[model samples]
Target: MATNQEEVKLFGVVGSAFVHGVQIALKLKGIEYEFVEEDLANKSDLLLKFNPVYKKVPVFVHNEKPISESNVILEYIDETWKQNPILPSDPYQKALVRFWSKFIQDKIVASFSKAVRAFNDEKEREKNIAEASEALKILENELKEKFFGGEEIGCVDIAAVFVAFTIPLIQEVAGFEFFTAGKFPKLYKWSKEFLNHSIVKEIVPAREPTLVYFKARYELLVSASK
Candidate 1:
């Protein structure tokens, strides 16, 4: 557990799914921290200084030390807090967890983003959607339990925050179906289980505003693609 003298702060934007993962990990660990909301249009000096390389949201600061990347921050929190541990203790299990987390970030998220960006081109959009669906199928096969970490939520579950929440929202905004219950039943069920968890419910952005935000952003992307 963190001491009273220890200070923790999260630098992120409200709508970022990557940022949400860090927030969920902090809450799960029962850590008390200040949330500094950043405006991406007008980046904050602290965020830039802390994450000079990416200059991105979701920079986690602990006792004046800054940590960039959501997955790295999640591991750090699990190691530091020790209570309600996010990653497994067994070496093999821990390695598996890390593997799935990286797969989600590199494979699943990347394909989904490409599909979303291929908005104006029909052939390109369908090709990207097929690629994204293929990636999701692999995840569906990997999920044999209620959550990615078996009965309990773990690092991989937190890593998939974007898949559970944001992808569905993007599907809604874009008027397409990539992560549907019919196509990927296991993944669909897992999404429900993950989203309905009390901690996740607390941190997820409200539906209406989040949809509106995505809709506006999607329009801009489509306009740019023209």
Candidate 2:
């Protein structure tokens, strides 16, 4: 294969924050690629084949080789494209950026999931939501200027995107609030701007389908906890 733009393919799961985050990065870099939607429930052969170890979506295929993990794929896309750079070139800045991204992935994302999973248990759910909000406040104060990337979208912004795009829908389904204008003014404002960012605006998954999927999933989890 000659390896034109179309040769770059991404295996994605619908309504997935990780998948959507990578897609947002690709669009930011002005990269053209095919997006293959994977049914995570059924576990597609293509996904399993490309990401055998994790057996997950968000496998970026370039020249027939697959890159697993959204953040790793994001850096790969930035390095390969060399336009609209995602990570800061300065070593210290780059390290700082990576630290925030890692924080989002390891700490924030898991908190959101735990909070959602505890929907049926009000006390557990409230505690988790409070912890998540405290964690978010760190990001809120970190936004000294326009984005996590300063004036442009960057790696940290991409990594913490779930807080901007998905949490509202999760709030709707779980009947709890974390990212709110009252509680996190800066983060709430960032969410609005993030959703309206030229590339991000276009790629946010449809609100209806996302709400439907999350609502159904939440119901299943809640029922199971009973």
* Model number with the top lDDT: 1
Residues 88-133 of candidate 2: C-alpha lDDT, one tens digit per residue: 8999998898788888877788887888887557788778777787
Count of clashing residue pairs in every prediction: 0, 0
Q: Work out the TM-score per prediction.
A: 0.97, 0.93
Q: What is the C-alpha RMSD of each candidate to the true structure, in Å?
A: 1.1, 2.0
lDDT of candidate 1 over 130-170, digit per residue (tens): 88888889988999899988898889999999999899999
Question: Lowest lDDT 10-mer window, candidate 2?
Answer: 1-10
Q: Which ten residues in a row have the lowest lDDT in candidate 1?
A: 113-122
Please report the TM-score between candidate 2 and the true structure: 0.93
- Candidate 2 deviant stretches above 4 angstroms: 1-6
Error of 2 at 127 (Å): 2.9
